[model samples]
Target: MWVNCRRYAVQAHNIGCYKTQQRPWVRQLEATYDVIVKECGLFVDQKRPFLGATPDGLVGDDTLVEMKCPYAARDLTPLEGVRKKKKIL
Candidate 1:
């Protein structure tokens, strides 16, 4: 199970077309961004929250770097999915 999960994580990094996965490159990007921050004098918000809008990493106060990965070619967004659910009601 562990091996399978790891493979899936790796695969998530490489989106074929519609699938967008950001976990794989998250660390790399974070590190790069961190170094860029360190050059100045800032840190990331580790304890904030994981709301969809929370940036993957932020620089200072003006920059927000949110990552994304699409699930499929036609998969609706969170809002769209919610709208569809409402229609069912």
Candidate 2:
């Protein structure tokens, strides 16, 4: 796989956007659902030390929140975006 500056820049921008939008979105979810979203750090598997996953939020004891803030579908609701662009993000 080839790494390009444009790709890196795009990824960085997307990450920045997501970070900027994340808190407000999480707050809305908490207010709407009355559930606390616990922030998480990188979680490593004990048995497989090399493998890990960092979830966006942890809801309750068992549910993990994985957020997708797609740059291409920023102006559309999730359902509409998914319907219109099935492969975006």
Candidate 3:
């Protein structure tokens, strides 16, 4: 369990760092969605400090966005495979 948790933490950190590099794309999303994306802070439950969330971006009043910037080759490979299968079918 500890090992899994550590692995998840590292994965989350890597993805978070990658997302920071994709701010332009995120800004485009905000423009397309017509929502002002606000910076998010660590939100902790008063009753349970350990239970907290640091969302990527907050939209307007109630929406939260978690952005993923996947590697282009990895992201396109599955879509290409699906397209090929669709052509066969």
Candidate 4:
């Protein structure tokens, strides 16, 4: 008879994978929203240059949306640089 050791580990991994899959749902929702906004006469500006590898987002004559999504359970350290608060020491 043989004993299995990683059964729980494998199950946890599967659950984690399932949780991660929810991320795409959020993305799809955002895309749908942006499209609706653009189609509603937001009029995206196309002449602007992109600065990074990420999507530059929709920029209309009167609107701009620079967006990103982060995992709730993961570190959000990257956001710190986006809006810096000057420390008063």
Query: Which candidate wins on lDDT?
Result: 2
Which candidate would rank higher by lDDT, 2 or 4? 2
Scanning candidate 1 in windows of ten residues, the lowest lDDT window is: 35-44
lDDT by residue (1-89, candidate 4, tens digit) is: 01233333343224554356434533554565554222221222467532212222334565544333334424434345334432110
Mind giving the per-residue lDDT tens digits that candidate 3 earns over 31-68?
77677888776677899966766677888887987765
- The whole-model lDDT of each prediction reads 0.43, 0.68, 0.60, 0.36
Error of 4 at 16 (Å): 17
Q: Over 4 Å off in model 1, which ranges?
A: 1-23, 31-52, 71-89
Clash pairs for candidate 1: 20-69, 20-70
Stretches > 4 Å off in candidate 3: 1-20, 70-73, 77-89
Q: Cα-based RMSD of the predictions, in order?
A: 11.7, 6.9, 7.7, 15.6
Candidate 2 C-alpha lDDT tens digits along 1-89: 12332344344325667768778877877886799999976677899976766677899999887676666776776468669964322
Which TM-score value belongs to model 3?
0.58
In candidate 2 the C-alpha lDDT for residue 3 amounts to 30
Choose 3 or 4, whichever is better by TM-score: 3
Among residues 3 or more apart in sequence or in different chains, the pairs in candidate 2 whose N, CA or C atoms overlap within 3 Å are none
TM-score for predicted model 4 compared with the true structure? 0.22
| lDDT (10s digit) by residue, model 1, range 1-89 | 33433454444225563134444445555565453321222233468633223234555667755455544424775457457662210
